[model samples]
Every structure is written in C-alpha cells, then in structure tokens.
Target chain A: MRLGRRFVIAVPTLWLLLFFMVPFLVVLKISLAEPRIAIPPYSPLWEWVNGSLKFNINLENYSYMWEDSLYLNAYLSSIKIAAIATLLTLLAGYPMAYYIARSPEPRRSILLLLVVLPFWTSFLLRVYAWIGILKTNGILNAVLLWAGIIDEPLVIMQTDVAVYIGIVYTYLPFLILPLYANLVKLDDTLLEASRDLGASRMSSFFRITLPLSMPGIIAGSMLVFIPVLGEYVIPALLGGPDTLMIGKVLWNEYFSNRDWPVASAVAIVMLVIMMIPIMILRRAQARGAEI
Target chain B: MSEHILAAETKPWVKGTDRPFVRIKGITKMFGDLAAVKDVSLDIYRGELFCLLGGSGCGKSTLLRMLAGFETPTGGAIEIDGQDMTGVPANMRPTNMMFQSYALFPHMSVEKNVAYGLRREGVPKGEAMQRTADMLGLVKLDGFARRKPHQLSGGQQQRVALARALVKQPKLLLLDEPLGALDKKLREETQFELIRIQEELGVTFIVVTHDQEEAMTLSTRIGVMDAGRIVQVGEPREIYETPNSRFVADFIGSVNIFDGEVDVAAPDLMRVNTSEGPVMCEPVAGLTARQKLHIAVRPERIRLSRTPLEAANTMQGVVTEVAYMGNLSVYRVQLPNGQCLKVTAANGLHEDNPITWDETVHIGWSAAACRVLVK
Candidate 1:
C-alpha cells in the first residue's frame, strides 16, 4: 500500500491496540494473579523477600466464583429483568411505530421528530428525570394524592419497577426507530390485495403485516436487551439492596470490598453471559437479511 | 328520475332479455376539492368483457377502484346482481380486483394464494384445496402450484393473480391494467388468454387500460374517459367506426380529422364544407344547423390510386411519405390545401405495382364511411 494509505489505516489500529486491547489484557493478567496484601489490594507484582523469584499465581478467584451461590443468582436475575424489559419495550414501541409509519406525510415527520427529541438531552439526565417522576415523593404520587385516588404516596422509589421504567424510557427511541424503518417499507397495496382476496382487515395484519415485521421486532429487542443487561446507574439509584443485580454485585466487589481478583472474575463471567444474546442476535440479523 | 328515462329509452333500444348485469348509477367521487369520477353511469352486461380506457390521471383506475369498493363514491350507487353495494367493505363485497402490479403474496405458494379467499369464507381445507387446484388448472398454472411468486416469471405471476381472484367466484372481476408489466409479445398473448378465460368462465370482467389496442382487442364494449368524465361508451366497432366526439375519435385510434362547418342537414345524411373541399357524412344525433363539426375518416377507408378516380368525394393529392410494414403500407398524402391524410393499404397483388413516394394520387371515400363528430 501507499505510504499515505498505510498511515490512515495504521493510526487508528495502533490507537486501538494501545488503548483498548492493552487494558483488557491487563485486566485478564490481574484476574489470574494470586491474592496478596499489597498497598493496592491484589497487585499482580510480587517482591523477592529472600532473593528468589517470588512468583505466585493461582485459580482461587475462578474457584470462588464457581462456588458462590450469590454470583449465580445475580446472573439469573439480570437475564430475567432484561427479558421482561425487552418485552415491555416491544409492546409499547410496536404500535407507536406503526402509527408513526401510517400517519400522513406532514404529520409523520413531526411524530418521528418527537420520538427522537428526547435524545437531545444526556441519557443519564433523562434517567434522572424519570427518577424524579417515579420516586415515592415524585410527580406520580403527588398527582394520585391530589386527585384523591390514593390517601398515601405509593412506594415506587428504590424498586425494580422503577428500574424497569427508567430503562424503557431511556431506550424507547432505540426500539422505535428500527421498527419504523421496517414498517414504513411495507407496501400498502399488499393489505388491499389481501382484502380483495377476502381476508378481513384484522386477518391481514396478523398473516401479512406482523410476520413481515418480525426482523424489526428481533432487532429492537436486541438493542434494548443487550445494554440493559449491564445496566448499573438506574438499578443502583432505584433498586434497593434486596435487588441483587449482577452489575451491582460487580460494582460492590470492585469498589466497596476492594477485591480486585474477585471483581475481575465477576466481570469476565458477566462478559461471557452477555455474549450469548449477542450471538443469538447476530444469527437473527443474518437470517433476516437473507429473508 | 334518470332511471325512468333510461328504462323508457331502454325498451325501444334493447329488449328485456338484454338487461344489464351490473349497473353503476350516478357515481361521483370527490377527493377534497378534486373530482375523480364525475356523475359516471354505465351498464355492464353479463359475461361481457368491458374496458375503461384512458390516459394517466383520467380517473379510469379510480372508477375501477370504486367498483372494487376500495373507494366509496361521494354520490351514487353500485349494484352487483341487482343488490346495492354502496357501503359494503371490499372483503364483504362479491367483487375482486386483479391489481396492476399483480400483488401476489410474496410468502405464500401459488396454491395457498389461490386458496386464501376460500379459507376466509370458512370452506373446509379439502374443498378449498380442490377448488384451488381447479382454478390453477383453469389458468394453466397447475404444475406451478408449489412455486412462490418471486420464483415465477412475470406472465406466470399474472396468471397466479388471475387465478387467485377467480377462485372466489366473484360476481364481477375488476382488472386494473392487467398485463401492463409484461413485455409486448407477452402482453398480446395474455390479452388473448384473458379473453378465452373470461369466455370459458362466463364471468363479467371490467378491464382498465391506457393502451388503446389492448382495449380494442379485449373489450366487448369500451368507455373512453378524459379529465375524469367518460366521453363515450359503445361497442368496440362503434367506438372505432363512429365516435360521438372528436376526443373519442382521436383517443381510440389514429384518424385523419377535418374541421368543417355543416353545409346541409338531411334526414339520412349531412354535408360538411372543409378547407380541402366539401364532404358528406352519415347523419348522427345532436346536430344543429350551421354548427361546427369534425369529420373523422379512418386511414384504411381512404382508397388511393395513381390516376384520378371517377368517384364521389374524391381528392387530388401528392404522396409525401410511405411507411412500409411487412404486410401493410401507409401512404401520407398531402392535398392541394396542404392538409395531410393517411391511406393504409394491405400488401397484395396490387403491391407488385405499388405507387412510389411523391407520386400524384387520388384519395376518395364513400359518404357513409365518415361520421360527423359534434365537439
């Protein structure tokens, strides 16, 4: 290759190698190091006290991770919450996407703009805005009390429901954009042909519209489900201690207990657990394209 | 009020046995401020192939859509088998449409697409399959039942669309520019195939097309539309030989038209005075004294000879150009007044001694061959 082309290609590759790959290798190395009481807990380096090479490495961290019941429970809970949230987002996004796709030309642009305008603000700030509304003393409770629907404030704060609401609100645009792309490409004449062929409007939707839009459904579910698996901020703020999410557990191990080896082990397992759906999503996307 | 007038006129025009199968009454459709079909009334009889012929944006497709119940008329009623279908949805109505694009289901097989309507009507699976197979056999697509739409050729796809529509046994079938997407040869072949199918099934068909030849070849009767209103409706021969107006004459076929003034109006015939010369026409309705009229003469009717013929209504002209097709020849003749008229002749023994271009020729037609078009 030419010198200029080599420079253009090699620069970002070198940057990634130094910044991204080096950090992951460092983490992996530290995860395999033995537990020792250094100034920074579980430092991989060993000191020669008796003038001999004092190298110590063990698989105790992996053994502990495998034996711990809490780690297993955290992984299972993460999957369940992400699955439920993905389903909820799909239920909410599908109709909104269809309506946007079916709206008049002038109104379709405005509706799509409104669906995406929430992204102008910071994602963390948006989640915080939801916090203000979903908390026990938030707008939801204030409205219920003012309307005399409830005598007391509802205990919505620091619960899994609030966490789910926070996640769905933040990722709604992600779910809707994909579904809209698929729904808008559908030919309206197909529905008319179906009706002309003696199928009712409702039957046409199920047999034609719904099946043809499955690729969008799978795509939107993946977009919401994958990131929400490792969600920390929403659960940390909204979920009580009783909420034993994997992200929270990993966070506790790394910061409060200062157990670096155990934290690294949990991080590796979480990475592996997250890769399952990613692989499944990749397969679905390939099949969707083929269809 | 109009029905009484139509019925009163119908008694003398056509007998009771020739009653129309489908009657469209005063159907006017308006989209906001624009009128798509304006006070259109037509009678399509049983087992007759009819065509709504026009150019784009002429509301021919809109009229077909209204017949299929895809668009409801702003005023008027559509009746199939003597039953009103004013507010009926397309699914509930006994009418089917063969779309212009042949909107076959991309996911379903041919057999499944044909069986869709029967299944929707709650027919048992075995009966539906039998009917679907029968329909496939009728359309000559029996062996291709397992193929999806995309797997078939354009002509085959059109046949699948036809079979799917006919499987329901609708009272009336509406085809919106059928065979439009096929090649020229395929379109011609499909046109004949469609006519044969309609004949065999004895079903009423209303075909919409912008191609004048397709309409002329396929329709038993045709309604020529312009600017959202039908200008004239008649049998194919009448539409070609005797159009009601200049617009219908020019739209249906190529003709040599002469703008003239009525010189005389007799009981059986009318005389018109044109810049080229005076000509005679068969007497038609809606004529007034000294009114401006258009005279249409078909290219084939004007006989050309090298020598001046001793005949009535003869014109002396020079051959300007000659277009030679394999079996026929068209001579463009320019009269003394600088008016050009076309004369088409079939190649035969006369072609062995044909007239060359730029030769002086005499063109004449019989008086009964021309129609006085009141435009």
Candidate 2:
C-alpha cells in the first residue's frame, strides 16, 4: 500500500520536474548570460576554452534593470494594478457569490451558470468587446447621451480606468467560484446560533460569516491577483501608453527589442516577487484544512 | 385571568403568584402548502424544563424555532414575560438556542465563543470576560478555555455550545437535540448534566428531542407532538402512563393496541369488545356504548405465566418469540385468535430459561394498566 501511494505521488512529481522545473532552470541559465546580436540572442554560460571549461557569466542584464527606472516602474505599476483589480473583484464578487449561494437550490445552479457564462467566449474577444463599449463614441457614452444623463461622449477607452474595468470584468468569475464554494458549505445554523446569542444581522455577518469565509477570500484573491499581475491581453488592448506593466515590458523586450537575456531576467524577478503571496496562500489553505 | 392563576397553582413547578414565562396562543406556521406547526397553544412556566418530543418531520423543531423567534407564526401571538413577541427578531428576544449540531464557532476559542453574546450586547470587556469565565466554570470547561471548538470532543463541544448560549442569561434557553451528536453513553450523561445546569441557573428551558427517554429523564413536562399538532401536554409519567391518543401511546413506547367498540359503559367500569377478546378497563368519562375506541397496554404492564390464571383480564396464548435483554425479557405471544401481544418481564435471578418458544402462557393485566383512547 505504501509503495502504491509513493508511485501515485511520484508520477505527478516527475511530470512537474520534467515539464516545469527543467524549463525554469533553462530560463535561469539564460538570465545569467549576456545578450548577443546573434540567432540564439544570448551567450552560453559555459564554453570550451583551451581544453578546459570557461565561464561566461554576465550580471549586466540585472544591473541594467536596476539602473533603468522604466523596468522598476513597470514592476511597481503591475503590482499596484493587480492589487487594485483584486480588491475590486472581491468587493463585487462577495455579494454576488453570497446571493447565489443563498438562492434556492433550483435557482442556485442557474446563478452559478451565469457567473461562468463569460468563459464561453474567448478572453481576448471579451476584452476587445469592452473597447467598443468604452470608446468615446461607444455604447456606454451613447446610452448616457440618449438617456440625457450626459450631454457629450465620455472618453473611457485606452486608459488605466478602462484597463481596471477590463481586468475586473474578465477575472470576476475566478473570484466568485471559490467564494461560492465556501459560502454554500456554511452551516445556516451558525447564523441562527449567532442571532440566538444576541447578535444583530450585520454583527452576525461580521462575527461568523466573514471569518469563516476567509479561506475562500484568500483563494479567490490569489486566483485573480496572480494572473492579473502578469496580465498581457487586457492591458495591451485597453491600456494607454502610460499603463506600464511588467508583462508588456517583457513582451517588448523579447519580441520587439530582441533582448532575450534581459527579458529572462525580468521573468525571473517577477517569479521571485510573486512567491510571497503564493506562500501565504499555501499557508492559509493548510490552516483552513486544519480547522 | 383569575382562572389562569388558579390553574397555575395546580402545577407543582408553577406558583400562583408567578406568571407563565412563555405564553404561546394558537401559533401556526405554514410553509407554502404545508403547515409545519398547526395552531398550537401552550404555556410554559418559569424555571420549568419543558421538552417538545416528536418523531422526525413532526414540527417539534419548528415550534422551538418559533419560540426562539427564528420563524414567524402565520397566526396568533407569543408573549414572553408579558411582552408581545409577534414581530420581534431573534436578536432582540430574550431567548438563546443551543443547536443540534452545537453550532460553536470553529474559529473562536471556547472563551471567545462564550463571550460572543455579551460582546454583541456591548457589555464591557471586563464583565464579559468574568461572565465567560464563570460560565465555563459552570460547564466544567474552564481548563480548556483557550482551545478552539474543533480541538474539543463532541461532548466538550456541546458544553461550549451550552456555555455560549447560557452566558447571556436570557429569560429562556432553547435546546434542539443538544445531545444528538454524542454517543449513547455520553448522551445519557449529558441529559442529566443539562437538567442540573438548567436547575442551577433557573432559566426556562424548551428542549426539542425525538428521544422519549431523554424527554422523560430531562424535562419537567413533555409536550407530545404528532403530525403538526401537539397531542398531549403533561408531566413525563402522566404522558407515559395515561396517553390521551393511540398516536401518543404508540410513539412514546412499545404497546399492543386493541381496536374495539365500546361494549358496556358503566359509571365504574368500561368493557371494550375487541376482536381478540373483551377488555375491561377503568372507566373513562364521556365514553358511550358502541363508540369506536382503542385499548393500549404497555408491554411492561402485562404479566406472563405458564399456567392459566383465573383473572378478570386474562388471555391464553403461545409464546412465539422470546428476546432476552440484559435486565428484561420481551415475549411475543400469539393468541388463538391470531392477534399478537407483546409482554415484557424483568429477568429475575431464579428464572433462567423461563418460558421458551412455543410454550402456552397466560397473559394478564390490571384494568388500570389499560388506557382507553378515542382517537
């Protein structure tokens, strides 16, 4: 039985090592090498010289990233944008998820289906559709003018606000799904017990419901924040030039500028920065399971 | 009002000077097409441990929820300490409920769970802490105050739930199968502890349970429920010995009911002409001749013997089955008329292998042991 259990776990561990760790090691090696104006676009970290191994390591790509404010600002802005979008998604998704969970059984499945309905369309196409709605003469502005709520068209496209709206809209289901799972499993008796113990409706919500659903909140936030941190399509289609993000910078560095080593260095730094929240999420999940 | 006072004086637990702590008048709760609790009126005295006993889906829990203010009655009113609670929410009502699952907050420590009610009431931290400590001590869980609910055993978690509900010292405490999660042994032990704690605190308790033994042992009074209506309300012994209907008699314990028509109705005795035999029972007022009725005799009340005894209420039967329980033996006797009667006898030390299967026996009971039910 123990051997079979070990074999079961070993298969997935071996697969992760080959598919994920090996590629990550390759990226790390490239990040330590210097960029070259050649076909491969980067120097090898080790070379054969006079029958002995010679090292050709370069710290210049990493140094250059620190020296340039553009890369630093891109990293900071990506973090900031992802954090704000995660907060917005949480604020919008909590009530939606709570209502869906509390809905009658027949209606609950339909509400959950509505939450995941956006996934039927391509994510890129959805972001593009937002462009038509958020543009100066778009559907939103046209509707406001037609309804006499505004006299002129509102300029919403190609801005940070538009980028935020796009990220929140696209990642909303990611946040709500986990939250709904947690909220639906909550015992209704707990709420009634809280009320029986003299807690008002709002107080009972804070004292019992909020604390119990913290795991879901953390899981949902990580789902949105991790992907939005490296979000490329939404910002590329809806953000203006001022919306500097690390994913966009990495794309420009590797595809447009052809600096593979620098781009690899940027990727390495992003992974290190994201490790904090990923570790926090694992710890929270473990604690939730323990409870 | 004077009549109410006079009636209250008759009850052992209720003094004539003290008013009913909870007065429910014709309260009915309907769910779409189903009436969960049909128009039920009951009066529970202060310091009385009243139990609502019924089978599953019998609306005992629904009545308890209505008393706790979780469910609004479709009609009538509930008065607690002379205050009308028709529209009052659960939080504002002077009642606390210990759930069947013992809904202790998993995230909170034992002390914190106990202090939650006082905190919601905006009590000062010092007093709340003191009271929480006192309540934990009362439940004998003071040593485990820092532990979370999951860290405790089922019985310990039950104590935490009890402490949390009682720390607020509400006018009434509602327990919905509070010992349902515990094992049989722990449940019996907790039943006594619950009664002790209830008496110590002097808080009116309304416990809902499906276990007849628990209700009999823990409650000062038991309200037996069937379908959606209360069938009888009295002390546990009265409910057990003198059930008003066949439903109550069959639900409370093992019984052999004889469906019959009233053959003779005298001022002193009544005779019921059952298919098996004519049953003589103690006279019940208002029972006329030819009226359809049932004669219910508890299993333990019937006497069994190998030889026929000349008795007023006796029948000859062959023992079909004998189940030897630890303290008692249950004998299923088959009569010549094809009717099966259940007889339970205590296993005395000298009566080993007493009356084996297929043995002819005489089954008898006193007239007072038989309860006549018209419903």
Residue pairs clashing in model 1 are A158-A238
Q: What's the CA error at residue A195 for candidate 1, in Å? A: 1.6
Q: What tens digits encode model 2's per-residue C-alpha lDDT throughout A168-197?
A: 999999999999999999999999999988
Q: Is the docking of candidate 1 incorrect, acceptable, medium or high quality?
A: medium
TM-score of model 2's chain A: 0.96
Q: At residue B352, what lDDT does model 2 achieve?
A: 61
Q: Candidate 1: list runs displaced more than 4 Å.
A: A1-31, A34-60, B1-19, B265-269, B283-289, B349-356
Chain A structural similarity (TM-score) per candidate?
Answer: 0.89, 0.96
Pairs that clash in candidate 2: none
| Candidate number with greatest TM-score | 2
Q: Taking the tens digit of each residue's C-alpha lDDT, what string does model 1 give over B1-375? A: 988878545442244467678888998999999999999998888887989999999999999999888998999999988889888999998889999988887778889888988998999999999999999999898799898788899999999999999998988999999989999999999999999999888898999999999999998889999988989988788899889889998988889899998888888777889999889877766777778988999999888887777655799999999999868898999999999998898888655678878899888898877877778
DockQ metric, candidate 2: 0.89
